[model samples]
Target: MKHLADLLLLGDPRLYQSCEPVLESELPLVPDWVADLHNVMEEIRAMYQFGRGIAAPQLGIMKRLIYLNVDRPQVIINPELTAVSDEQDELWDDCMSFPNLLVRVRRHRSLTLRFRDELWRPQTWDVTDWGLSELIQHEYDHLNGVLCTMRAVDAQSFRWRPTPTH
Candidate 1:
């Protein structure tokens, strides 16, 4: 399979459309796609020096899959936010799809997520760190066809800034 090159940019219809769940029949492809996503994310990070997580929709795959390079790299399949803490924080958010812009948005400070690992075994992750919570929430929004731009606090909160390329 060809490695994904162009991530779905902002205003792309695919980025705003809900992705379909990966069926059992498609499980075999998950590993390869996850690897592809990993490669693309690493390439993005190398060039732009940013990007911690990526969802399948950003790659134009329209599947409920996300790869996160937090403490340890992991692939999340069919992820669902089981719960969120009452605390919320507003932070600048960026995405691979629109690397030139940053939007300030509010996100839960803590959240509970349930997802299947690369092996298809169910797993639960309880996130309390504000940064990780925001990262996961951002990917979760992608799975639901919501972008940081959509969640922007206000027009004045959106700003265009070039990604850091060091």
Candidate 2:
């Protein structure tokens, strides 16, 4: 099982490489991968108190897979974004890869997410909520070797996350 310590950090070269699509023949391995992802995500949540989604590459899986647990657990495979709105919103986005930093970036206010479920069934979701939309976009960027730091609005858009008071 993968742990928080296995997570790829911000400066890892693998994090800058684009991921490959998960093949149909690889479906059998997805369960274990998702389990590891869930474990690491849970650890991130426990340590940093914020994490809604994580990509496979974050754990060095190097596949177009994302595990998201907002209202519930969701396994997204080879996701594609469509119907992205021209409207945008700026927010301080954080990542498990660099938990102590946040990047100010602009994201689409709404989008349509198309992907395969764990059963290899096609699924579509219209994400209109700003929070969910941004979360999905952030994860999708990972599959393309794009980091939140790359999307920063400006050089001054990066900030350290506030340390909690004991």
Winning model by lDDT? 2
Given candidate 1, what's the lDDT at residue 122?
94
TM-score per candidate, in order? 0.94, 0.98
Q: Per-residue lDDT of 69-99 in model 2, one digit per residue for the tens?
A: 9999999999999789999999999999999
Clash pairs detected, candidate 1: none
Model 1, residue 67: C-alpha shift (Å) = 0.2
CA error at residue 124 for candidate 2, angstroms: 1.3
Which stretch of 10 consecutive residues in model 2 shows the poorest summed lDDT?
A: 157-166
